[model samples]
Target: MHQNPGGLSAAEIHTERKEQQRRRRNSLLLVVPILLFLFFAFVAPISSMLHRSIYNPTLVELIPDTINALSSWDRTGTPKPETLRTFSIELQQLAKQRESGRLASAVNRSYPGATSLINATARKLRNVDPNQLAQTGHLALLDTDPRWSETKLWQAIDRLGAKYRIDNYLTALDLERDAQGNIQKRQSSNIYIDLYSKTLSMSLIITLLCIALGYPVAYCLAHAPARIAGVLLVMVLLPFWTSFLVRTTAWIALLQTNGVINSVLQSVGIIHQPLELLYTPLATILAMTHILLPFMILPLYSVMKGIDPSHVKAALSLGSPPFSAFVRVYLPQTVPGLSAGSLLVFITAVGYYIIPALVGGTEGQMISNIIAYHMQQSNNWGLASALGSLLLAVIVILYWLYDRLVGASNLKLS
Candidate 1:
């Protein structure tokens, strides 16, 4: 009931403050669910994957006493008597716990043939008396397997004993630590580096192809009459309406040696024999381009629709050639769309798994296929996580470069 000098009552001011607080509370309530969903669904999984890339605990947990003993021995010399005794006792306990396989599997990641040796030793130790093992020490272990005397096997065990390591990442990059602990290129044939290079190159080629094919379609859609433009836009987006798997399958059917495309070509007398099209890198590129073409077209169409045709006309009216007017005036205006579409297509193409895996035979497989192989077939989660993390890092770096060169704020989409 109290009136202020400005003619508003104190009650009115209190009501305004209460209304503002209520609105803020409602806004926060709406956002809380989305934030929780992101943390649990997206953020948490990525954090766990990144952590797995560096963390490994199977060996250390399975043979703690042995790891403790190895900590004291100089990796350069042969194992001491006490260290050997500790390793023997731990190996017996690990076998009794049925965990020798886990240890062997972990070791096999670094030294290929060590799994069989470790398993064999565990089997041999199962028959020997623990008391005899304690008494005989290093000699008993050597009788079980001469490889136990090898420094390299011990070195592999020592490496896995660490709870966290960079070995996964190093291996993903086709590099490893030598016996001297020096970082060096792996002795094995390098596959990861080549796969990474191929991934990048293919992504680049796909992005360029999408841009080349999408631009004309977008331009036509943007400039046509309203009814015509709507029809054209629908045609551009028709592929997206279909199932992705169906589209990929259709491409395989069309590109197969005796499939629709080859049949049409032969019917037209283009060739006597069918050309090998399916399961090739060219098929991968073509299918990916088709799958991603709409992404490019939508952004380009959105930008072109907003552009005033009069600007290009004004440039032409000033005596500039038509091509020159377009290059200098219209093309520059569409750059934001071009950049957004290219980045979207490139990033998506780099992570492509299904298309490349199904269409791309051995010669066309990408890094994502390798990651899947390690995860599912090899059961090498650490290596898979490392490859995924490296791919994520590459994407982040590319995004940072794009943002620096062409402001992310400039990106537009329909």
Candidate 2:
């Protein structure tokens, strides 16, 4: 029973250390479920999105022979005779396997008419002799679909050879390659950049609106008596009890032309006709600001509550003017809450989908709406993933900037 420095027996000390280690292990085990959930729910999807945004192997895997053959051909126009021969041969094989539709879909994503052309030709070439397809590949392909002679279709086929490329990302940014292979702005369609700009602008507007609206409410709550503050806090959080869809649709009902607001305004003789409100950017901004206002207020109230009133009181008692004391003393102390609330509201607004989709019409559509369109409607998953990845990149950059500029340690929750 040898005793160590603190007069405890060696065995007791060992048992205490073992108990501490067991506690640490238990704590880690308790967090394991959350760590696993985050990995599966958040990390895995984002990792897949980042990967899929660039890597697409559908065409390369489907038509390996053609992809290999087209390796050396200059993409000025259609490929060489042998490359077309290889592609024609692969088309017959794919048609035999009933996988030509997949090829058509993959190609049609880059070049629209390829679906009709490829499917039709694959059907025509399905029964063609494989040996003859190998011999007169270009002729057979060209004969089946005269459109095969088109340079654009051939260029699209040439592009599929790169199993991993940023072509989708480039397209997401409203850019495409020229005939000479230099990336340039897409002349045919340029909607994404504008939508991205609108998204950021709308999010900023929502954040500012939240600050404007939330700051005063938070100040009141922080300064009020505990009994009154509890009632005020409940009022602030009352919105959370309502369904999100209900809240959003409530805005729709209020903003729509024959709705309560318009009817009330008309009754009050404010205007002859109902002002156009629904389906506009203003509708989205207002709804988002309202929905996110609580997020702003909570952080602000939390920070402002902890701040010592004496600091402002002392500044005032020292003969400082009220405005000057507030600006120089109290406002500086509230930076933590302001930064926390602004970042929270802005991030949430930036990624917001449901409210905007329901309230935001064409005029108010954000980048998220377009991303959803590409994913759900057009099924351009690659483009959607690229857009999402780019958005994620932007958000990460913004978050890093915020953290660098404002210091993440002071965000009220802590």
Candidate 3:
């Protein structure tokens, strides 16, 4: 029998290879469900958000012929008469379908009085015969609204007619391009940048507060007797058993002007009047810190549980000062958990919505509140997606900076 030196037979080796391939296929099959879940849950929504931020099809779909006609004419003046006639016919069709609302909204985002311009022209066009729309519809539209005579109105149509745009991102950043296409600060709606700063600042404060408050509790839980540690750990995790909304509303009761805290303070003679604490930034910070403190403590306690108490004792045995022993020998061991908990708390605090929305009055509203405003109230999903994409980018960049400078995965053991 002929065989390779390392194999019993070529057929045997081939059978083994088939067995390995089958195992590999089975392994992949086992994970396919999770992979599909991740793709649909995370990747799909993110892709949709990214696409919405740039590609809006409302204007392009509503008046494709009008946009195609405007393509030939320079944007320096009113579009050609044919383009106006085509736009009038499309508006008439949309009016018939009751779909003018979306177009009016899209147009108004770009140009003022766009609803009036589009709706009024639609009203005027219902009287025009569709067959004659190609002949005299442009004149009818001009008679309906003299604003159509203006260059800016046509410019907005031509701009929004394209399927892809960066205007949403520009507006999200409180910026705009001038007529000459130079990027400049927007005179109107110049609040997004400030909101981003406030969000980041508030998130940082919440992280720090979580650390200051959670670290001691975590250390105590880690070092206490097993019986006491189990009870303390329950206290830490007790918040999870309650509904999140219930927990947040409990703060509403505590911080409200005539609520438990104010009544207690008044009874104790600490103050005569109730404080305006419920709907302010301080309330946002405190509530968020409370909600996120357990995130810090749990990670810290987990890490601290595995840490050796003898490390600090050994440092003191070597004649090191107590503070020096704690800092130099013991503190390094907790860096992994500290970084993880900080990152968890900070990211959660940054994207927080319900807490801020419930308690954050006008003065305390964060960037997420503005994003919700754009999506829910204003129906400006493009701007909301752009803001969300920007927020995601900021968190990613900050994480990258942290990994580079602090190295979150850097585990030090001595």
Candidate 4:
């Protein structure tokens, strides 16, 4: 071993090669568990959800014969008896598999006539032995039901069975389809679109309010003495230390008819009435602004803190107006923080549920409320998923747009 100090002997060279191979093998072994974890935990769930979104399980697997056979017919016209026969057989198989409910449910979503489609097929199936499903006479047995001759019924079945559709998207938009694939908005007076609009509008309003209030506060904190800044920052962070629900509940009590704000206002003769503040849009905006103000303040403070004080001093030395110097020199530097804070607050506010549910009126309730409604009140997973997916899409697009706009501006500056 001592003789191999300057150069590797054959045994030493082999040992070094073995050590390198062991490291490579260990690294590969380490990577495998991480990749497997990502696949199982993150990737698999997302793939499953996306699959569920387009998952038309009832028709595709059950009625393959009918879907394949009806490739040429117009939905508005009558279909031949052979098509009905194909559907009838598929329905019988589906019933045997205990999947007829899914078929009926899917058909009910697309067309009213198919309410009895599955039941009719099931009844016919009951009358005959399982071996007789292939017999020609089974077709006549199905023809007894008027749904068997309905072209739109078969079309709906085929769609629910075969199509990877935008129907869920339309439904989230409070729209639907007709027999000819034409889209129409829902005529219901109460719907998801209203909730969606309210959500966006409320979020935007809250974001603007946060910026207006938080900007000055953050500016003061940024330019203050270090001790003062520390105190203000501690105050800003204090809410975060408290439980979110506790803060929201505190707001509920404070905004109530006999609560502190109303009591003080009445004592000062500002208004005689409590003014319905607790369950109004004002309460939602106020509470959300209070809760989200720190989000706006911290980012703005970070940006403002990094700014050179001499920039404004230089502008002032050049005979620029104080306000003008501040606007010209100070405001542009804060864009990064402003954009960051707005994006954070808006994204969080849009998906807000608990705060709005507690303080928002019927008029102020957001889309998340409706999603929760469908999940808890209605137990309609498809509708809820459609809404959830749409909300997620909206957030994604908004973030993308924010990134592009901010990135472009940053590029121009550089």
What are the TM-scores, per candidate, against the unseen true structure? 0.93, 0.91, 0.95, 0.76
Model 1 lDDT on a 0 to 1 scale: 0.90
Q: Write the per-residue lDDT of candidate 4 for residues 29-76, one digit (tens) a residue.
A: 989999999999978876765665665555666677878878766676
Candidate 3 residues 1-414, lDDT tens each?
679999579889889999999999999999999999999999999999999999888888988888899989787877888888888898899988888878888999878789887877777687678878888888888888789889888888888888999999999889986665578999886699989999999999999999999999999999999999999999999999989999999999999999999999999999999999988999999999999999999999999999999988889999999999888877788888898999999999999998998997887789999999998899899999999999999999999998886683473342
In the order shown, the candidates' Cα RMSDs to the true structure are 2.7, 2.8, 1.8, 5.1
Give the alpha carbon lDDT tens digit for every residue of 1-414 in model 2.
777789999889889999999999999999999999999999999999999899999988899988887778777777788888888889889999999998999888778888988999989999988888888878988887778878888788888778899999998898988766789989886788888899999999999989999999999999999999999999999999999888999999999999889999999999899989999999999899989999999999998999999999999999999999999888878898999999999998988888878888889878888889889998888899999999999999999999987885455433
TM-score of 2: 0.91
CA lDDT, every model vs. true structure: 0.90, 0.89, 0.89, 0.80
The TM-score measured for candidate 4 stands at 0.76
Pairs that clash in candidate 3: none
Lowest-scoring 10 consecutive residues by lDDT in candidate 1?
405-414
Candidate 3: C-alpha RMSD after superposition = 1.8
Per-residue alpha-carbon lDDT of candidate 1 for residues 1-414, written as tens digits (9 for 90 to 100): 779998988989889899999999999999999999999998999999999999999987888888888898789767888788778877888788888898888999888897898888888787678887887867878887787888888888898899899999999999998887789998888899999999999999999999999999999999999999989888888997999889999998999998999999999999999999888889889999999999999999999999999999999999999999999889989999999999999999999999999888888899999999999998999999999999999999999999977884455321
Query: Which stretches in model 3 have alpha-carbon errors above 4 Å?
Result: 408-414
- Backbone clashes for every candidate come to 0, 0, 0, 1
| Best of the two (1, 4) by lDDT | 1
Q: For model 3, give the 10-residue run with minimal summed lDDT.
A: 405-414
What lDDT score goes with residue 211 in model 1?
96
Q: What's the C-alpha lDDT at position 411 in model 2? A: 50
